[model samples]
Structures are given as structure tokens and as C-alpha cells.
Target: MPLAVGPYGQSQPSCFVKMGFVMGCAVGMAAGALFGTFSCLRIGMRSRELMGGIGKTMMQSGGTFSTYMAIGMDIRC
Candidate 1:
């Protein structure tokens, strides 16, 4: 197969790491949202606190998962 060329005409590696990061972020955010919502509800959190907690959980989980997935993909490559 021919190598992929970038806009500057330089050969570029495949997008496996990028894809892994995106997929991991999406999955992690979804999981986080579900768990965060339930945990907040169980704790009786309301309004701003509930929303803030969930958002924080989602961001942390997404970033953590994406970083790990990207590293794994880089290693595989």
C-alpha cells in the first residue's frame, strides 16, 4: 500500500492513535455520565451540585481513558 501524504507532501503515519483516543473518550464519557448520575442521585445531590459533579466526572474519566488509549495505540504502532 502507498503511504499517506500530509498536506506538506510528507508521509504521515496512520490515524490509529487518534481513533483510539476518540473512541476511548466517547466510551469513557458515556460510562462516567451513567455512574455519576446514579451516584449523585443516590447521595441526594440536586441542581447545580448534581450537574457539576457529573460534568467533572465525565471530563476526568474521558481524559484519563483517552490518554491511556492513545498510549496503547502508540505502543501497538
Candidate 2:
């Protein structure tokens, strides 16, 4: 009483393999695009402009606040 039969009532391996392959690819792409804590820190650290004192602080704070605002106001917590 299963619904996974091929044209001749044979169980189709390709059907399940295609579904698993699609899911695996989606998961792999998602994992690759994930930006976690260390990634955030690295992007922040590397984005500092070569300006000294207030200029440097301005650049860093701009990035920090941009990220904060982008992820902040939309949060429901």
C-alpha cells in the first residue's frame, strides 16, 4: 500500500535519492551562508578604515550601528 512505486511497481531508489540530494544541497548552501559570531567579529575587525582616532571610531561605529539597526528593529523580542 505504498505510493513510491515505479512504472512497473518496482520501488524507485531514484525518487528518494533525488529528494535527499535536494535537501542536502539546500542545507549545504544555508550552512555556507550562515554568519555567526566569529564571522561578525572578523567583518567588524577587518572593516576599520585607516583613519586614526575619531575617524576610525566613526567608521567602526557606522558599521556597528548599521548591523544593529538592520537586525534590531525587526526583532520581536
For lDDT, the strongest prediction is 1
TM-score of 1: 0.79
Q: TM-score of each candidate?
A: 0.79, 0.32
Residues 5-50, model 2: lDDT tens digits:
7798786544444444445444443443343324545556434332
Quantify all predictions' global Cα lDDT against the true fold.
Answer: 0.89, 0.44
**Candidate 1: worst-modelled 10 consecutive residues by lDDT:** 11-20
Worst 10 residues of 2 by lDDT: 45-54
Model 1, span 12-51: residue lDDT tens = 7668878989988998899899989999899999999999
Off by over 4 Å in 2: 1-13, 35-77
